[model samples]
Target: MLASLRQERILAAVRLHGAVRVADLVDELDVSDMTIRRDITELARAGLVRRVHGGAVGPDTGSRPAHEPGFEAKRSWATAEKQAIARLALTLVEPGQAIALSAGTTTHLLAHLVAADAALRPLTVVTNSLAAAEALHAAVTPAGLDVILTGGVRTPSDALVGPVADASLAQLRVDTAFLGVHGLDGDGLTTPNLLEAATDRALLAGAAHVVVLADHTKWGVVGLARIAPLDEVDTLVSDTQLTAEARRALDPLVGRVLLAPPDDPTPEPPLDPGAP
Candidate 1:
Protein backbone atom coordinates (compact mmCIF):
# COMPACT_ATOMS: atom_id res chain seq x y z
CA MET A 1 0.00 0.00 0.00
CA LEU A 2 1.04 3.59 -0.54
CA ALA A 3 2.49 5.39 2.44
CA SER A 4 -0.39 7.83 2.64
CA LEU A 5 -2.93 5.08 2.49
CA ARG A 6 -1.08 3.02 5.07
CA GLN A 7 -0.77 5.98 7.40
CA GLU A 8 -4.42 6.86 7.02
CA ARG A 9 -5.29 3.30 7.95
CA ILE A 10 -3.11 3.51 11.00
CA LEU A 11 -4.89 6.69 12.06
CA ALA A 12 -8.21 5.00 11.52
CA ALA A 13 -7.18 2.02 13.58
CA VAL A 14 -6.13 4.19 16.48
CA ARG A 15 -9.35 6.18 16.32
CA LEU A 16 -11.45 3.05 16.32
CA HIS A 17 -9.59 1.28 19.06
CA GLY A 18 -8.52 4.33 21.10
CA ALA A 19 -5.01 2.90 20.75
CA VAL A 20 -3.40 0.21 18.67
CA ARG A 21 -0.61 -2.24 19.38
CA VAL A 22 2.54 -2.18 17.28
CA ALA A 23 2.40 -5.90 16.72
CA ASP A 24 -1.19 -5.64 15.46
CA LEU A 25 -0.21 -2.96 12.98
CA VAL A 26 2.78 -5.01 11.84
CA ASP A 27 0.65 -8.07 11.27
CA GLU A 28 -2.16 -6.18 9.61
CA LEU A 29 0.12 -4.24 7.29
CA ASP A 30 2.61 -7.06 6.83
CA VAL A 31 5.43 -4.74 7.76
CA SER A 32 8.40 -5.53 10.00
CA ASP A 33 8.44 -4.59 13.70
CA MET A 34 10.98 -1.92 12.95
CA THR A 35 8.77 -0.51 10.24
CA ILE A 36 5.80 -0.34 12.59
CA ARG A 37 7.92 1.33 15.19
CA ARG A 38 9.00 3.91 12.63
CA ASP A 39 5.40 4.51 11.64
CA ILE A 40 4.27 4.93 15.24
CA THR A 41 7.14 7.31 15.86
CA GLU A 42 6.08 9.43 12.92
CA LEU A 43 2.50 9.63 14.16
CA ALA A 44 3.68 10.60 17.64
CA ARG A 45 5.80 13.32 16.12
CA ALA A 46 2.79 14.75 14.26
CA GLY A 47 0.88 15.39 17.51
CA LEU A 48 -1.71 13.00 16.22
CA VAL A 49 -0.95 10.21 18.66
CA ARG A 50 0.58 9.52 22.06
CA ARG A 51 2.82 6.45 21.89
CA VAL A 52 3.23 4.26 24.94
CA HIS A 53 5.40 1.21 25.35
CA GLY A 54 3.85 -1.01 22.68
CA GLY A 55 1.10 1.10 21.10
CA ALA A 56 -0.14 4.63 20.29
CA VAL A 57 -3.21 6.43 21.61
CA GLY A 58 -5.49 8.77 19.69
CA PRO A 59 -4.81 12.47 19.49
CA ASP A 60 -6.21 14.63 22.27
CA THR A 61 -9.83 15.15 21.19
CA GLY A 62 -10.04 18.56 22.81
CA SER A 63 -8.06 19.97 19.86
CA ARG A 64 -8.37 19.59 16.06
CA PRO A 65 -9.31 16.91 13.51
CA ALA A 66 -12.80 15.72 12.58
CA HIS A 67 -11.60 12.14 12.74
CA GLU A 68 -8.62 10.42 14.30
CA PRO A 69 -5.36 9.82 12.49
CA GLY A 70 -4.24 6.23 13.01
CA PHE A 71 -1.21 5.61 15.24
CA GLU A 72 1.16 5.04 12.34
CA ALA A 73 -0.22 7.97 10.32
CA LYS A 74 0.00 10.62 13.06
CA ARG A 75 3.48 11.73 12.14
CA SER A 76 3.30 12.33 8.43
CA TRP A 77 6.11 14.87 7.89
CA ALA A 78 7.44 18.21 9.06
CA THR A 79 7.66 17.03 12.66
CA ALA A 80 11.00 18.76 13.35
CA GLU A 81 10.08 21.95 11.55
CA LYS A 82 6.76 22.28 13.36
CA GLN A 83 8.36 21.66 16.75
CA ALA A 84 11.07 24.20 15.99
CA ILE A 85 8.49 26.81 15.03
CA ALA A 86 6.63 26.05 18.25
CA ARG A 87 9.78 26.69 20.29
CA LEU A 88 10.37 30.01 18.57
CA ALA A 89 6.80 31.04 19.22
CA LEU A 90 7.19 30.31 22.94
CA THR A 91 9.91 32.96 23.05
CA LEU A 92 7.31 35.59 22.10
CA VAL A 93 5.20 35.10 25.24
CA GLU A 94 6.11 36.76 28.52
CA PRO A 95 4.94 36.27 32.08
CA GLY A 96 1.45 37.51 33.07
CA GLN A 97 0.29 38.45 29.58
CA ALA A 98 -3.15 37.68 28.27
CA ILE A 99 -2.60 36.03 24.92
CA ALA A 100 -4.88 34.57 22.30
CA LEU A 101 -3.98 31.54 20.18
CA SER A 102 -5.53 30.61 16.85
CA ALA A 103 -6.51 27.11 15.86
CA GLY A 104 -3.97 25.05 13.88
CA THR A 105 -1.27 22.42 14.29
CA THR A 106 1.51 24.98 14.56
CA THR A 107 -0.32 26.96 17.20
CA HIS A 108 -1.17 23.71 18.92
CA LEU A 109 2.54 23.08 19.25
CA LEU A 110 2.90 26.59 20.63
CA ALA A 111 0.33 25.70 23.27
CA HIS A 112 2.40 22.70 24.34
CA LEU A 113 5.58 24.76 24.47
CA VAL A 114 3.91 27.28 26.71
CA ALA A 115 2.66 24.49 28.94
CA ALA A 116 6.09 22.90 29.16
CA ASP A 117 7.79 26.05 30.42
CA ALA A 118 8.13 25.93 34.23
CA ALA A 119 9.08 29.53 34.87
CA LEU A 120 6.03 31.11 33.25
CA ARG A 121 3.07 31.33 35.54
CA PRO A 122 -0.58 32.39 35.79
CA LEU A 123 -1.17 33.11 32.11
CA THR A 124 -4.52 34.42 30.95
CA VAL A 125 -5.02 32.46 27.75
CA VAL A 126 -8.05 32.82 25.51
CA THR A 127 -8.86 30.63 22.53
CA ASN A 128 -11.73 29.59 20.29
CA SER A 129 -10.20 26.21 19.62
CA LEU A 130 -11.14 23.27 21.81
CA ALA A 131 -7.75 21.63 21.36
CA ALA A 132 -5.84 24.81 22.12
CA ALA A 133 -8.04 25.56 25.11
CA GLU A 134 -7.51 22.07 26.41
CA ALA A 135 -3.75 22.28 26.06
CA LEU A 136 -3.56 25.69 27.69
CA HIS A 137 -6.02 24.71 30.37
CA ALA A 138 -3.97 21.71 31.31
CA ALA A 139 -0.81 23.77 31.34
CA VAL A 140 -2.03 26.88 33.12
CA THR A 141 -4.64 25.81 35.67
CA PRO A 142 -2.21 23.56 37.48
CA ALA A 143 0.10 26.52 37.77
CA GLY A 144 -2.82 28.68 39.03
CA LEU A 145 -3.44 30.52 35.78
CA ASP A 146 -6.74 31.44 34.13
CA VAL A 147 -7.88 30.23 30.70
CA ILE A 148 -10.98 31.42 28.87
CA LEU A 149 -12.43 29.45 25.95
CA THR A 150 -14.96 30.95 23.56
CA GLY A 151 -18.12 28.96 23.16
CA GLY A 152 -19.71 28.55 19.74
CA VAL A 153 -20.42 26.00 17.11
CA ARG A 154 -17.63 23.45 17.01
CA THR A 155 -16.17 22.64 13.59
CA PRO A 156 -14.23 19.68 12.24
CA SER A 157 -11.03 21.65 12.65
CA ASP A 158 -11.78 21.87 16.40
CA ALA A 159 -12.57 25.59 16.33
CA LEU A 160 -15.49 27.19 18.15
CA VAL A 161 -17.30 29.68 16.00
CA GLY A 162 -20.71 31.21 15.21
CA PRO A 163 -21.93 34.39 16.98
CA VAL A 164 -20.86 33.53 20.50
CA ALA A 165 -17.11 33.40 19.91
CA ASP A 166 -17.24 36.60 17.91
CA ALA A 167 -19.16 38.46 20.58
CA SER A 168 -16.93 37.13 23.34
CA LEU A 169 -13.76 38.26 21.57
CA ALA A 170 -15.11 41.74 21.08
CA GLN A 171 -15.73 41.98 24.81
CA LEU A 172 -12.09 41.36 25.71
CA ARG A 173 -8.65 42.62 24.66
CA VAL A 174 -5.28 40.87 24.77
CA ASP A 175 -1.64 41.90 24.88
CA THR A 176 -0.33 39.51 22.25
CA ALA A 177 -1.82 36.86 20.05
CA PHE A 178 -0.49 33.81 18.20
CA LEU A 179 -2.42 33.13 15.00
CA GLY A 180 -2.57 29.83 13.15
CA VAL A 181 -4.08 29.46 9.73
CA HIS A 182 -4.44 27.28 6.64
CA GLY A 183 -2.45 29.61 4.38
CA LEU A 184 -0.63 32.93 4.17
CA ASP A 185 0.31 35.09 1.20
CA GLY A 186 1.25 38.59 0.07
CA ASP A 187 -2.44 39.52 0.26
CA GLY A 188 -3.19 38.19 3.76
CA LEU A 189 -4.04 35.08 5.76
CA THR A 190 -6.52 32.49 4.41
CA THR A 191 -8.38 29.45 5.58
CA PRO A 192 -10.48 26.80 3.83
CA ASN A 193 -13.51 27.60 5.97
CA LEU A 194 -15.37 30.88 6.15
CA LEU A 195 -16.38 30.54 9.80
CA GLU A 196 -12.80 29.89 10.83
CA ALA A 197 -11.74 32.99 8.95
CA ALA A 198 -14.20 35.11 10.90
CA THR A 199 -12.99 33.71 14.20
CA ASP A 200 -9.35 34.42 13.39
CA ARG A 201 -10.22 37.93 12.26
CA ALA A 202 -11.92 38.57 15.57
CA LEU A 203 -8.87 37.34 17.49
CA LEU A 204 -6.63 39.66 15.45
CA ALA A 205 -8.90 42.61 16.11
CA GLY A 206 -8.85 42.00 19.86
CA ALA A 207 -5.05 41.76 20.23
CA ALA A 208 -2.50 44.57 20.57
CA HIS A 209 0.10 42.70 18.51
CA VAL A 210 -0.50 39.69 16.34
CA VAL A 211 2.22 37.12 15.65
CA VAL A 212 1.35 34.59 12.97
CA LEU A 213 2.72 31.03 13.23
CA ALA A 214 2.51 29.41 9.83
CA ASP A 215 4.86 26.82 8.37
CA HIS A 216 6.43 27.21 4.90
CA THR A 217 3.77 25.18 3.11
CA LYS A 218 1.12 27.80 3.97
CA TRP A 219 2.87 30.63 2.12
CA GLY A 220 0.95 30.58 -1.19
CA VAL A 221 -1.97 28.20 -1.08
CA VAL A 222 -5.30 30.02 -1.29
CA GLY A 223 -8.21 29.46 1.02
CA LEU A 224 -11.78 30.77 1.39
CA ALA A 225 -11.41 33.73 3.74
CA ARG A 226 -8.93 36.52 4.35
CA ILE A 227 -8.18 37.21 8.03
CA ALA A 228 -6.24 40.44 7.66
CA PRO A 229 -4.56 42.74 5.20
CA LEU A 230 -0.87 41.99 4.82
CA ASP A 231 0.31 45.10 6.63
CA GLU A 232 -1.77 44.37 9.71
CA VAL A 233 0.29 41.52 11.10
CA ASP A 234 2.82 42.73 13.71
CA THR A 235 5.11 39.77 13.29
CA LEU A 236 5.41 36.71 11.06
CA VAL A 237 7.25 33.60 12.33
CA SER A 238 8.03 30.66 10.10
CA ASP A 239 10.58 27.89 9.72
CA THR A 240 13.77 28.17 7.59
CA GLN A 241 12.26 26.04 4.84
CA LEU A 242 10.42 29.11 3.52
CA THR A 243 11.39 29.84 -0.07
CA ALA A 244 13.07 33.00 -1.37
CA GLU A 245 9.92 34.02 -3.19
CA ALA A 246 7.86 33.68 -0.02
CA ARG A 247 10.43 35.64 1.98
CA ARG A 248 10.39 38.39 -0.62
CA ALA A 249 6.61 38.42 -0.65
CA LEU A 250 6.40 38.61 3.15
CA ASP A 251 9.15 41.20 3.67
CA PRO A 252 7.17 44.15 2.33
CA LEU A 253 3.93 43.48 4.19
CA VAL A 254 4.65 42.51 7.79
CA GLY A 255 6.28 44.72 10.42
CA ARG A 256 8.86 42.13 11.51
CA VAL A 257 9.50 38.71 10.02
CA LEU A 258 11.41 36.24 12.24
CA LEU A 259 12.99 33.37 10.27
CA ALA A 260 13.86 30.56 12.71
CA PRO A 261 16.82 28.39 11.75
CA PRO A 262 16.15 24.73 12.43
CA ASP A 263 19.83 23.96 13.20
CA ASP A 264 21.59 27.20 14.16
CA PRO A 265 21.52 28.57 17.70
CA THR A 266 22.48 32.11 16.63
CA PRO A 267 18.98 33.27 15.89
CA GLU A 268 18.41 35.68 13.02
CA PRO A 269 17.00 39.11 13.69
CA PRO A 270 13.60 40.22 12.47
CA LEU A 271 13.67 41.39 8.86
CA ASP A 272 13.38 45.15 8.55
CA PRO A 273 9.89 46.16 7.52
CA GLY A 274 11.15 48.94 5.23
CA ALA A 275 14.29 47.36 3.76
CA PRO A 276 13.83 45.97 0.31
Candidate 2:
Protein backbone atom coordinates (compact mmCIF):
# COMPACT_ATOMS: atom_id res chain seq x y z
CA MET A 1 0.00 0.00 0.00
CA LEU A 2 1.03 3.61 -0.54
CA ALA A 3 2.55 5.53 2.38
CA SER A 4 -0.37 7.98 2.42
CA LEU A 5 -2.90 5.14 2.54
CA ARG A 6 -1.00 3.35 5.32
CA GLN A 7 -0.77 6.54 7.34
CA GLU A 8 -4.49 7.16 6.80
CA ARG A 9 -5.27 3.66 8.03
CA ILE A 10 -3.07 4.19 11.11
CA LEU A 11 -4.79 7.45 11.92
CA ALA A 12 -8.20 5.84 11.45
CA ALA A 13 -7.35 3.03 13.82
CA VAL A 14 -6.04 5.38 16.47
CA ARG A 15 -9.10 7.58 16.21
CA LEU A 16 -11.51 4.70 16.30
CA HIS A 17 -10.01 2.82 19.23
CA GLY A 18 -8.59 5.89 21.03
CA ALA A 19 -5.18 4.12 20.90
CA VAL A 20 -3.29 1.60 18.75
CA ARG A 21 -0.17 -0.42 19.40
CA VAL A 22 2.65 -0.27 16.88
CA ALA A 23 3.01 -4.08 16.76
CA ASP A 24 -0.68 -4.50 16.05
CA LEU A 25 -0.48 -1.76 13.44
CA VAL A 26 2.44 -3.48 11.74
CA ASP A 27 0.47 -6.71 11.57
CA GLU A 28 -2.73 -5.02 10.39
CA LEU A 29 -0.93 -2.97 7.77
CA ASP A 30 1.41 -5.79 6.71
CA VAL A 31 4.43 -3.62 7.12
CA SER A 32 7.72 -3.67 8.99
CA ASP A 33 8.07 -2.28 12.53
CA MET A 34 10.35 0.47 11.27
CA THR A 35 7.79 1.50 8.67
CA ILE A 36 5.04 1.74 11.29
CA ARG A 37 7.30 3.70 13.58
CA ARG A 38 8.19 6.12 10.78
CA ASP A 39 4.54 6.57 9.90
CA ILE A 40 3.69 7.21 13.55
CA THR A 41 6.49 9.77 13.79
CA GLU A 42 5.24 11.59 10.73
CA LEU A 43 1.66 11.57 12.01
CA ALA A 44 2.79 12.84 15.38
CA ARG A 45 4.76 15.64 13.75
CA ALA A 46 1.66 16.56 11.82
CA GLY A 47 -0.31 16.71 15.12
CA LEU A 48 -2.54 13.92 13.88
CA VAL A 49 -1.75 11.45 16.67
CA ARG A 50 0.14 11.44 19.96
CA ARG A 51 2.93 8.93 20.18
CA VAL A 52 3.37 6.84 23.34
CA HIS A 53 6.11 4.32 24.25
CA GLY A 54 5.00 1.49 21.96
CA GLY A 55 1.92 2.97 20.33
CA ALA A 56 -0.11 6.02 19.46
CA VAL A 57 -3.36 7.51 20.73
CA GLY A 58 -5.75 9.99 19.17
CA PRO A 59 -4.64 13.61 19.40
CA ASP A 60 -7.74 14.52 21.42
CA THR A 61 -7.88 11.35 23.51
CA GLY A 62 -6.62 13.05 26.69
CA SER A 63 -3.04 12.14 25.81
CA ARG A 64 -1.75 15.41 27.19
CA PRO A 65 -0.46 15.27 30.77
CA ALA A 66 -2.72 18.16 31.74
CA HIS A 67 -5.83 16.89 30.00
CA GLU A 68 -8.62 15.93 32.39
CA PRO A 69 -11.88 14.43 31.22
CA GLY A 70 -15.07 13.89 33.17
CA PHE A 71 -15.72 10.42 34.56
CA GLU A 72 -18.57 9.66 32.16
CA ALA A 73 -16.38 10.44 29.15
CA LYS A 74 -13.59 8.19 30.40
CA ARG A 75 -15.90 5.32 31.43
CA SER A 76 -16.40 4.26 27.80
CA TRP A 77 -12.75 4.41 26.70
CA ALA A 78 -11.55 0.96 27.90
CA THR A 79 -14.51 -0.79 29.39
CA ALA A 80 -13.33 -4.38 28.90
CA GLU A 81 -9.84 -3.80 30.21
CA LYS A 82 -11.14 -1.94 33.24
CA GLN A 83 -13.59 -4.73 33.97
CA ALA A 84 -10.81 -7.31 33.79
CA ILE A 85 -8.62 -5.31 36.12
CA ALA A 86 -11.51 -4.84 38.51
CA ARG A 87 -12.22 -8.55 38.57
CA LEU A 88 -8.59 -9.34 39.29
CA ALA A 89 -8.51 -6.70 42.01
CA LEU A 90 -11.59 -8.23 43.62
CA THR A 91 -9.59 -11.35 44.38
CA LEU A 92 -7.31 -9.31 46.65
CA VAL A 93 -10.12 -8.54 49.07
CA GLU A 94 -10.54 -10.81 52.11
CA PRO A 95 -13.52 -11.28 54.34
CA GLY A 96 -13.84 -8.79 57.22
CA GLN A 97 -11.06 -6.62 55.83
CA ALA A 98 -11.30 -2.84 55.54
CA ILE A 99 -10.42 -1.49 52.09
CA ALA A 100 -10.29 1.78 50.28
CA LEU A 101 -11.22 2.52 46.67
CA SER A 102 -9.94 5.67 45.08
CA ALA A 103 -11.99 7.56 42.53
CA GLY A 104 -11.79 6.24 38.95
CA THR A 105 -13.95 4.12 36.69
CA THR A 106 -11.91 0.98 37.31
CA THR A 107 -12.13 1.26 41.09
CA HIS A 108 -15.77 2.21 40.73
CA LEU A 109 -16.40 -1.10 38.97
CA LEU A 110 -14.56 -2.96 41.74
CA ALA A 111 -16.87 -1.31 44.23
CA HIS A 112 -19.84 -2.88 42.46
CA LEU A 113 -18.24 -6.32 42.65
CA VAL A 114 -17.48 -5.92 46.34
CA ALA A 115 -21.03 -4.76 46.99
CA ALA A 116 -22.58 -7.84 45.40
CA ASP A 117 -20.40 -10.51 46.98
CA ALA A 118 -22.00 -11.90 50.11
CA ALA A 119 -18.87 -13.91 50.82
CA LEU A 120 -17.04 -10.65 51.53
CA ARG A 121 -19.54 -9.70 54.19
CA PRO A 122 -18.79 -7.91 57.48
CA LEU A 123 -16.40 -5.64 55.56
CA THR A 124 -15.73 -1.93 55.69
CA VAL A 125 -15.12 0.22 52.61
CA VAL A 126 -13.88 3.78 52.68
CA THR A 127 -13.74 5.82 49.50
CA ASN A 128 -13.60 9.28 48.07
CA SER A 129 -15.65 8.26 45.02
CA LEU A 130 -19.27 9.26 45.10
CA ALA A 131 -20.06 6.71 42.40
CA ALA A 132 -18.42 3.93 44.40
CA ALA A 133 -20.14 4.95 47.63
CA GLU A 134 -23.47 4.96 45.86
CA ALA A 135 -22.88 1.54 44.33
CA LEU A 136 -21.97 0.05 47.70
CA HIS A 137 -24.87 1.72 49.47
CA ALA A 138 -27.50 0.67 46.94
CA ALA A 139 -26.26 -2.85 46.22
CA VAL A 140 -25.61 -4.18 49.72
CA THR A 141 -28.29 -4.73 52.36
CA PRO A 142 -28.76 -6.22 55.85
CA ALA A 143 -25.74 -4.19 57.08
CA GLY A 144 -23.07 -6.60 55.96
CA LEU A 145 -20.85 -3.84 54.59
CA ASP A 146 -20.13 -0.37 55.86
CA VAL A 147 -19.55 2.42 53.31
CA ILE A 148 -17.84 5.65 54.19
CA LEU A 149 -17.66 8.64 51.85
CA THR A 150 -15.14 11.34 52.48
CA GLY A 151 -16.25 14.95 52.38
CA GLY A 152 -14.46 17.32 50.05
CA VAL A 153 -14.62 19.27 46.81
CA ARG A 154 -15.55 17.12 43.82
CA THR A 155 -13.50 16.85 40.65
CA PRO A 156 -14.68 16.17 37.12
CA SER A 157 -13.78 12.52 37.60
CA ASP A 158 -16.26 12.29 40.53
CA ALA A 159 -13.48 12.10 43.17
CA LEU A 160 -13.84 14.04 46.35
CA VAL A 161 -10.52 15.74 46.94
CA GLY A 162 -9.17 18.50 49.14
CA PRO A 163 -7.99 19.04 52.70
CA VAL A 164 -11.20 17.59 54.03
CA ALA A 165 -10.76 14.31 52.19
CA ASP A 166 -7.13 14.17 53.14
CA ALA A 167 -7.94 14.72 56.79
CA SER A 168 -10.59 12.06 56.78
CA LEU A 169 -8.20 9.55 55.21
CA ALA A 170 -5.48 10.44 57.70
CA GLN A 171 -7.67 9.42 60.60
CA LEU A 172 -8.34 5.92 59.34
CA ARG A 173 -6.33 2.95 58.10
CA VAL A 174 -7.34 0.18 55.70
CA ASP A 175 -6.07 -3.28 54.83
CA THR A 176 -5.69 -2.31 51.18
CA ALA A 177 -6.25 0.54 48.80
CA PHE A 178 -7.15 0.01 45.16
CA LEU A 179 -6.13 3.11 43.23
CA GLY A 180 -7.27 3.92 39.70
CA VAL A 181 -4.81 6.22 38.06
CA HIS A 182 -4.71 8.39 34.92
CA GLY A 183 -1.19 7.21 34.09
CA LEU A 184 1.61 5.06 35.45
CA ASP A 185 5.09 5.59 34.06
CA GLY A 186 8.61 6.16 35.39
CA ASP A 187 7.36 9.32 37.06
CA GLY A 188 5.03 7.13 39.14
CA LEU A 189 1.27 7.09 39.61
CA THR A 190 -0.32 10.32 38.44
CA THR A 191 -3.53 12.23 37.87
CA PRO A 192 -4.32 15.46 36.05
CA ASN A 193 -5.85 17.08 39.08
CA LEU A 194 -3.42 18.22 41.78
CA LEU A 195 -5.91 18.15 44.63
CA GLU A 196 -6.94 14.67 43.62
CA ALA A 197 -3.32 13.61 43.64
CA ALA A 198 -2.92 14.86 47.20
CA THR A 199 -6.04 13.00 48.26
CA ASP A 200 -4.79 9.86 46.52
CA ARG A 201 -1.52 10.15 48.36
CA ALA A 202 -3.45 10.32 51.60
CA LEU A 203 -5.24 7.16 50.51
CA LEU A 204 -1.89 5.50 49.91
CA ALA A 205 -0.61 6.57 53.33
CA GLY A 206 -3.56 5.00 55.14
CA ALA A 207 -3.37 1.56 53.54
CA ALA A 208 -1.24 -1.35 54.71
CA HIS A 209 -0.97 -2.40 51.06
CA VAL A 210 -1.66 -0.59 47.80
CA VAL A 211 -2.83 -2.01 44.48
CA VAL A 212 -2.87 0.15 41.39
CA LEU A 213 -5.51 -0.55 38.72
CA ALA A 214 -4.47 0.69 35.29
CA ASP A 215 -4.90 -0.48 31.70
CA HIS A 216 -2.16 -0.87 29.10
CA THR A 217 -2.90 2.50 27.52
CA LYS A 218 -1.81 4.22 30.73
CA TRP A 219 1.65 2.69 30.55
CA GLY A 220 3.59 5.51 28.90
CA VAL A 221 1.38 8.47 29.62
CA VAL A 222 2.21 10.87 32.49
CA GLY A 223 -0.23 13.10 34.26
CA LEU A 224 0.02 16.62 35.72
CA ALA A 225 0.19 15.56 39.35
CA ARG A 226 2.20 12.80 40.95
CA ILE A 227 0.46 10.57 43.48
CA ALA A 228 2.98 7.97 44.65
CA PRO A 229 6.01 6.24 43.20
CA LEU A 230 5.83 2.74 41.69
CA ASP A 231 7.87 1.31 44.55
CA GLU A 232 5.10 2.21 46.93
CA VAL A 233 2.62 -0.01 45.09
CA ASP A 234 2.31 -3.56 46.41
CA THR A 235 0.74 -4.88 43.24
CA LEU A 236 -0.42 -3.58 39.88
CA VAL A 237 -3.30 -5.27 38.08
CA SER A 238 -3.47 -4.51 34.39
CA ASP A 239 -4.90 -6.20 31.31
CA THR A 240 -3.02 -8.71 29.09
CA GLN A 241 -2.50 -5.99 26.53
CA LEU A 242 0.41 -4.75 28.70
CA THR A 243 3.51 -5.62 26.71
CA ALA A 244 5.89 -8.26 28.02
CA GLU A 245 8.71 -5.73 27.88
CA ALA A 246 6.64 -3.38 30.00
CA ARG A 247 6.02 -6.10 32.55
CA ARG A 248 9.72 -6.97 32.79
CA ALA A 249 10.55 -3.33 33.43
CA LEU A 250 7.72 -2.95 35.94
CA ASP A 251 8.28 -6.15 37.94
CA PRO A 252 11.22 -4.74 39.90
CA LEU A 253 9.52 -1.41 40.42
CA VAL A 254 6.56 -2.90 42.29
CA GLY A 255 6.10 -6.01 44.43
CA ARG A 256 4.41 -7.92 41.59
CA VAL A 257 2.52 -7.42 38.36
CA LEU A 258 -0.76 -9.20 37.60
CA LEU A 259 -2.13 -9.28 34.05
CA ALA A 260 -5.83 -9.98 33.80
CA PRO A 261 -6.97 -11.60 30.59
CA PRO A 262 -9.55 -9.41 28.91
CA ASP A 263 -12.05 -12.25 28.57
CA ASP A 264 -11.05 -14.36 31.56
CA PRO A 265 -12.37 -13.36 34.95
CA THR A 266 -10.36 -15.95 36.87
CA PRO A 267 -7.58 -14.29 38.87
CA GLU A 268 -4.10 -15.47 39.61
CA PRO A 269 -3.39 -16.39 43.22
CA PRO A 270 -2.27 -13.46 45.33
CA LEU A 271 1.48 -13.42 45.89
CA ASP A 272 2.62 -13.14 49.47
CA PRO A 273 4.44 -9.85 49.93
CA GLY A 274 7.06 -11.58 52.08
CA ALA A 275 7.84 -14.18 49.42
CA PRO A 276 11.02 -13.66 47.52
Identify the leading candidate in terms of lDDT. 2
* Residue 178 in model 2: lDDT: 95
Candidate 2 segments exceeding 4 Å error: 1-67, 140-142, 265-276
Per-residue error (Å), model 2, residue 29: 8.6
RMSD of each: 11.6, 7.3
- The CA-based lDDT of model 1 is what? 0.72
Backbone clash pairs for candidate 1 read: 10-70, 11-69, 11-70, 42-75, 43-74, 43-75, 62-131, 63-131
Write the residue-wise lDDT of candidate 2 on 1-276 in tens digits: 999999999999887888887768877989976688779879988999976545777776654434567777577666788888888899899989999999998898898788778899889999999888877876555568888899999888889999999999999999999999987777588787899999999999999999999988678566667899899999999988787767877988999999988677454222222211
List TM-scores for all candidates, in order.
0.68, 0.78
Model 1 bad stretches (over 4 Å):
1-77, 263-276
Model number with the top TM-score: 2
**Lowest summed lDDT over 10 consecutive residues: which window, candidate 1?**
267-276
Where's the lowest-lDDT run of ten residues in candidate 2? 267-276
User: How well does candidate 1 match the true structure, expressed as C-alpha RMSD?
Assistant: 11.6
